[model samples]
Target chain A: MFDIRSSIINQKKYKVFYAIIPFLALFIALFIGGVLIFFAGINPWKAYNYMLQSIFGNIRLFSEVFTHFVPLVFCALSFAVAYKGGFFNVGGEGQLYFGALTATLAGVYIQGLPAFIHIPLVLLTGFIGGAFWCWIAGILKIKLGADEILNTIMLSYLAILLINFVVMYFLKPANSYISQSEKIAKSAYFPKLIPHTQINLGVILSLLTVIIIYYFLYRSPYGYQIRAIGENSDAANYAGMNILKGTMTVIIISGGLAGLAGASMLMGTQYRLTPAFSPGYGFEGIGAAVMARNNPWGIILTAFLFALLRVGAGAMQRGVGVPLPISWTIEGIIMILITGSEYLSNKFSTNLIGGRA
Target chain B: MKKSKVFLRVFVLAFAILMIFSTLAMTAPLKIAIILPHAITSEGWTKSGFDGLMKAKEDFDIETSYQENVSEGELKGALRGYIAEGYDLIIVHEMGYNDPTLEVAEESPDTMFAITYGFKAADNVAVTSGTNWQANSLAGAVAGLMTKSNKVGFIISNDSPVAHNFLNAGFIYGAKRINPKAEVITTFVGSWSDVVKGKELAKAMIKQGVDVIYSQCGVVNRAVIEVCEEAGIWAIGAVEDMSYVAPQTVIANALAPTEYLVYGVIKEMVEGTLKGGRVVKGIKDGAEEITFNPLLKDKLPENGEEKIMKLRQEIVDGDITLEQMQEELNKQNIKF
Candidate 1:
């Protein structure tokens, strides 16, 4: 009745449970938000209606939601790529900033190119910039046995400061009235997808990136080896897999993804280098990646969920006269619930399968 | 005998002119230097200061040099560098640089120091600024005359006395003068850049029947204008002309031209009347002025121009004073 291979896991039951998890998480999150809404002296139904209507009812606002969605998905993909190879890349923020810096430099300095060449050139440099940041952490982790988490966290702040210091002096516009760089060349800007909305080529690129990463993680031999090492490094090593190369490649890809996020933001709406450009998209990416269970396709949905919270935050303020921090409460509840559920599920699986109970 | 005497007199006059020219060459033009917090173009605030420095150079014929992007931490060092360079008049053309400016000024007491947008002063330091009171008072006067609802609103970033004394008090005084029953509903949105909060607060005021509102929160000014545009109401803009931002909604703009403050301080220095005190000037000194929306020019009530011109004249003539408004506010228990 309890054969190890056959009954170790009930596939059908697990599939059903897995399918229900997101809905359950969503329900629980909304419930917590509802309770807070009640305390804020606003009707929960009206508040939720306002949140949804603010984004969906207006085409312009809906496009803005995608603008937020692009960065979240890229960041999530960045985290997911490294995490799939048994590495935790926490420096997406730094990498993203570095990418933005390089993109801005290219956009502002590298002149005399047509739109086609310039956009790609700027975006490529951004990816390289991010990859360069990631490569240092990867080398430190693999070659020198350093903690990537700490290295990335520290380096992220360095990247932000580096951009600020550079822009404050050498890169500053001749007649700039603010502490920011000159606007990037018009040709280097991302093509607009909608006339009035902020939706740009970044959204299309993000979707394509998701598909490409999904294939890279599932189809290629390198992908299999990376996942194998993630599952059991010793086992993979005994099977003649190159753990060093696999891990490094994962990190570079992760960094590139994050860098793309930075480049997109710069080329899309911002058009220049400013310190306040990123609103913790780097950290939020990690959250989205974890929420998606590192699944490439699931990341899109998770990113949209977070975007919903952000885009709706303003409407919540405008509609019910509730403070914007109400969104933060819902975000906190969702994070805790997702983390708690994952912890409980792992233990449940361990007891059931590991113990053969 | 007459020809010889004439030649002698001409020779003596030529020699005297040569001596005067050589003596003038020995002295140099006034060496004035300015330190700004930003580059001179694009943004309006720092540009005004830079423009003032340029104008001072042209008007007073002073030698001028400038350093931009000198942060607060670097302000003392920058000021010291100017002192070492033997600049006659040194100016920190930005707000919130008082402490370091005064510290550097005290170290070199003989050197004159000037800072913009502060109330502090010392023997070697002069605080030159445009008064926020008059610009806002003028906006209030317009709102009071224009509002059909008898309720004007004043939305600010925070509860600073600087704002309460100048923006709120001055606004209330002007509005009450036009319509004594007019209520000034003031709200603080906590931060200047919180556009969402700005719009929501503006909407809340609109719900309370505030037809004409004054927005003084820097970037949130756009949000307030947007709310007014959405509600088809009137809004008075601050700091810069915002008719371009919301053509249909922005009725008038309160201006803070820093060039006036800069030019005035430099003139004082050149005239040897540069006293160490807060020299806050408005309207008359060209520091602040209330400008009507050119786009909505026809929307103005008949005699609105005459009425505004008279108020401005009174303000310029010292008949309508900020001190009087401050006393009025104090009388009404409106201190911080």
Candidate 2:
């Protein structure tokens, strides 16, 4: 049981095992997905073909996939950062709604500024709004010893209601039939990267965020302390690392990342805030982060993979006869497999790396 | 090594087979795709849309498909997916799809887009509304005449001022026309499928002396009908002939001629007669009507069905106007 020397040596051998797990897990998930398609009375081969053709066959379709992928990357990284600091950050959805609401308000009323000045101002306001919403849970956890999970979950409900109220009464366009705010000012719009496609400046910003987060998490001293706190908060406290301050910093950064996702949708694609604008992207971000094992670089791959499945799902329905619910079923099965693999890897690693059985 | 070899072989084989099928799909007939915000299997609103699409598919001999449970966020992606697949006609079956439909229609001008309950239109977009207000007016008139309490209830799912304000105002107007002393009470459950809440709201209205309830509560309308049926209060149905849901309780059901409207649109498209603009079909155009439940016909007030039918025909003939109804409400100081 006291084999610290052997465990240290076994760490080198375990790197190869860790590297292969995600690919193996994804393959297993897709294989199960194939079985499900076969059971649905359609040839699994045809369905896969339809999905592939719809996603990659045309420039416009691929651009649409890219448009959806940008927000997922920001959202996944947000969750990944929070997870790195041992905070669950279940309030991402609420934070996202608040971000969108603030961004929409700023975009609608803040006028007569140049695009260079106006766009950043609106996005920064959105980030601040999201950070403030999550800061409530942070303060609650630190001061009252309240559960951040419950606080974040409840905050999400409040955020949704808040946005709905604002859109219904205040921001709503006069005489407009739908419950959506007026379009953002022209100066605040994210310039489209591709004509006639929704791909916009958010894609470039998301890439920059991924790189910055990677550098912050892996190459910075603060990042080391946060990782240490995540591993063992009591040990980190004994080492003179301020756990509470570290938690506060990471959760706020995580919230800001999710807020950027809201900005991406508001500026990049939607250009106005509408009801149900997120459609669970914030929650799905948690799924993407989990599949990536909270690695910033891995999040990019996983987010694109999820976007591929989503963009192809609609095509699967029209090109073939598979119901829309089956698309969600496929995603659910894959997420289950990824989580299962994560559990299995952790279980086997403790034994293989010279820990007590 | 052996497992890798087998996996590679299977992958290659699957890829080869997929290519063959992709080529075959390119040669299929003109495809039509409909995107629904709710599940297609639901018995009320989505079901009507599904029935209409199926009827169009059969009548025109064109290939039609639908993606259900789509959210507003996913609307643009779903529409573009259909457009990318070379679909000739795209049917967005919800009002929230308005802006997205317009955006996609502008991007792909050749593809014909039809939207239900949509207000705005573009060069290639056609907006069709069911105009269920006429049927609600008739149902309101019947409630006005039959209510002993002189107070009727209107329960709506959500409070979208534009989509519903007219129907609610119409109900009040119709009620006032027959019984000048009648009063209308309105309640919103804030959700479409909350049966418990619907029942609670309906019960409260019944206690307040609401003898009749005109419900636009979607699937949860059953809950309102259940409460009404138990308390011996009258109820009117919505969107379809929901009399079978509670045969003994429902007095009249508002029939939105969804199938006729959808099939008629498709027929026009095939005959090259469809154009882009707003197409509103009401009682006169046979797009909407009210059907009294035959089982409860005797329980209703004498000459009630006859008078409702006369009013319905008068609406069709433009004898009674929405303005006149609004004026009547104003005169009585009734707020819808």
Candidate 3:
């Protein structure tokens, strides 16, 4: 009993350490970024100062950041939920696209319904569409033992082609010059939360989603089962957990969350579905999930950081005259440093504990 | 106390080094930056823009610098960086930069900024665009006359007004003039560089009995030309004379000849003749034309060259306007 208590305490301590490590790594990345700025013949202090100003300076830019943040939060949450259940969902992009496609179809085809009914129906359709697509991969993994990673990636390509076909052949607008779906019904759109700035109810939905996900992952029976399976699949099975059912549930939920991200992007921002609709938010969510170590609150923080980078990078381009490709380089560097630091700290602590033992 | 002194000395040394570098950078002659929408290795579209900057550097004795593969989201930041660095002129090589360029122009009124494709005018911002629609219409006239199946296709990169006006309108109007019953089908591959998707779309159109294709996209058209050649269908190229890529099947090309436009703009900028407003270049200004593939010379219809020359003259004389083309099409009840 004493040994169990001590082991639990040790695990809790390690969890805290793991949580704090990424933030430290981020600071280190900023320092390296400063060096890069200096090498580029610009004052590092002014560059960083301008970056901050660009992020928080005006209502329009700040709102734009938050606008980008909403989808990221939802995508990160989706990844967090599945990650906690030990399922690696690489199909978030496909799921998001399908969600947008379904929401678009709902917005176009489903008419005569009241705003209250139409809006929610469209959002729900997005969730169901994404979940259904993900369930295909889940079913394959659980039933046929196919690799979820490969299956999900393949499905993403198919989903893109499928959306293109639908937009071109079936949902094509009257103009027919542009191969895109018709404009979504005005009633289907999410109302702007902040006027004049693209900030919509999607941000609120994303926040609520984070809270809900936190509760679902940490405070519920199903959540416990998920965590248990994540910790050790064999042990979870030994404890009378239904492995296939748990897998299916997590996969579907993960896909649904990603789909919600698509719904948020479509209804809140773009009013119509375009080919370049997603700026790779689904894949970016995976980065957030990894950086946050699969914690709901952590995912939120990391997602905001990424949003800052994206928005600030835009300002950086306009303000600093740095090429846009440099932003990708900066992001790639930051990710590498964070992941590398985590690896190093884990190894260091493991060695220390083993030595003490 | 000793450690503190050591730290202070090191800080002082670093400050001095930074100051020296800053002075050297500031005193440097001309700082010009170019932001391209696509990678240098991708194709000639962006490379042509960069080449213009390079030529300007040699002629005007200006420092030339560039960045490639810039997305819409990152364009503003790239512009800001160059402005902060005090670049004399910043050229953004893409149409999507219109909105971001407007914002940046307002922020840095002193910076002379130029963009291709889309037009958003400011005191310091200049918009340069090609007569792509006119050139496409010219190419369309040729495709309309030559196609064996009376069905032509267009591979659109994305759903933008500029792209829509050029390919769809031109094809429809031109097709109706030559072959009233001609059916024109268009497909958007959703990207300017998605060759695989472009090929697949062209193949699908071919399967639907489309015998001639006009690809308005830049690099993506490479696949369309390839697929058309393999399938023995005629294809129209965009920008440069891509007829050489697959000479046998590429019947003609809608040429932008960005090199001439870029050179002209840079020369005007140097001569202080570049006005800060929308500048529209067309066939009348020798900015765009249709280059017939030499390989297809024998296969051309007997009166093809003569008919095209007459239409060009009528267009230039304003006797046959683009609006008139649309009006004629409406009279025939033809839709793209």
CAPRI category for model 3: incorrect
When only the first chain is scored, the TM-scores of the models are: 0.95, 0.93, 0.92
lDDT tens string, model 3, A1-357? 986677667767776777677777777777877777778877777877887886676665677677568888888877788878888888888898899899888988887788789888998999998898888988888889899889887887788777766776677665454455666788888888776565788888888888988998899999899889988999999999988788788998899988888887878766666554577888888888888878888887899999888876666655664555666677777789778877887786676455232
Worst 10-residue lDDT window for candidate 2 chain B reads B157-166
Q: How far is B33's C-alpha from truth in model 1 (Å)?
A: 41
The lDDT per prediction is 0.80, 0.83, 0.77
- Residues A204-320 of candidate 1 have per-residue lDDT tens digits of 999999999999899988899999988889999999999888888888898998898899888876677764457778998998998898999999999999877776764565345
User: Candidate 1 vs. truth: CA RMSD?
Assistant: 24.1
Candidates in descending lDDT order: 2, 1, 3
Winning candidate number (DockQ): 2
DockQ of candidate 3 compared with the true complex: 0.12
- 10 residues in a row with least lDDT, candidate 3 chain B: B71-80
Q: CA lDDT of A261 in candidate 2? A: 85
**Model 1 Cα shift for residue A96 (angstroms):** 0.7
> Where in model 1 is the C-alpha error above 4 Å?
A1-9, A354-357, B1-336
Top-down TM-score ranking: 2, 3, 1
- Model 3 lDDT, residue B74, Cα: 46
Backbone clashes under 3 angstroms, per model: 0, 0, 17
Share of reference contacts kept by candidate 2: 0.73
